[model samples]
Target: MKNLFFLGEIMSDISVEELAVILEEDDKWLTENYNKLIQQYPGQMVAINDGKVVAVGREVRDYCAARQKAGLVGPLLINVPHPDDLEPFLI
Candidate 1:
């Protein structure tokens, strides 16, 4: 029984497309680090943002969706200003 959690600042500036990208990337990263996360917590998927812990569940999809509803996307790099930053070097 895995539980998922997501945390972040919910503001009006967030975009759906940008959030989608973040979710996709996060999913990829999770898959890559699955072994480590599982070893530490066999049944928990916790999402953290700005040093705060949020939602917890067994399904990753559900966690991502909940975050989307809040308008925060991605486990993006701390320095990146927005999700589009992943597209090209912002001049």
Candidate 2:
């Protein structure tokens, strides 16, 4: 079922369920390779597709564009920040 999204919202071509599966794959990959990503891609953007690392770059748009240019669709893009790069909660 295609739900209506408001204008200006950046929507993916895939449905919510598909996105959830992709996110789950991303989470699994992160779980298995947390240390590697922090060391390799600290403060950078990375894209994962089909439970594999597809692209790595400094900017999200650039990498995603590169992936698109390579004909990849609906990749899960995430920022792998440095281990010490943390944000504290404030009221």
Assess each prediction's global lDDT (C-alpha) against the native: 0.48, 0.67
In model 2, the worst 10-residue window by lDDT is 1-10
lDDT of 1 by residue, 23-63 (tens): 56665666565445445444544564433334444566666
Per-residue lDDT value at 81 in model 2: 70
| TM-score, structure 1 vs. true | 0.40
Find the candidate with the highest lDDT and give its number: 2
Off by over 4 Å in 2: 1-13, 83-91
lDDT accuracy of residue 24 in candidate 1: 69
TM-score of each: 0.40, 0.68
Candidate 2 is scored at a TM of 0.68
RMSD of each: 13.6, 6.9
Best by TM-score: 2
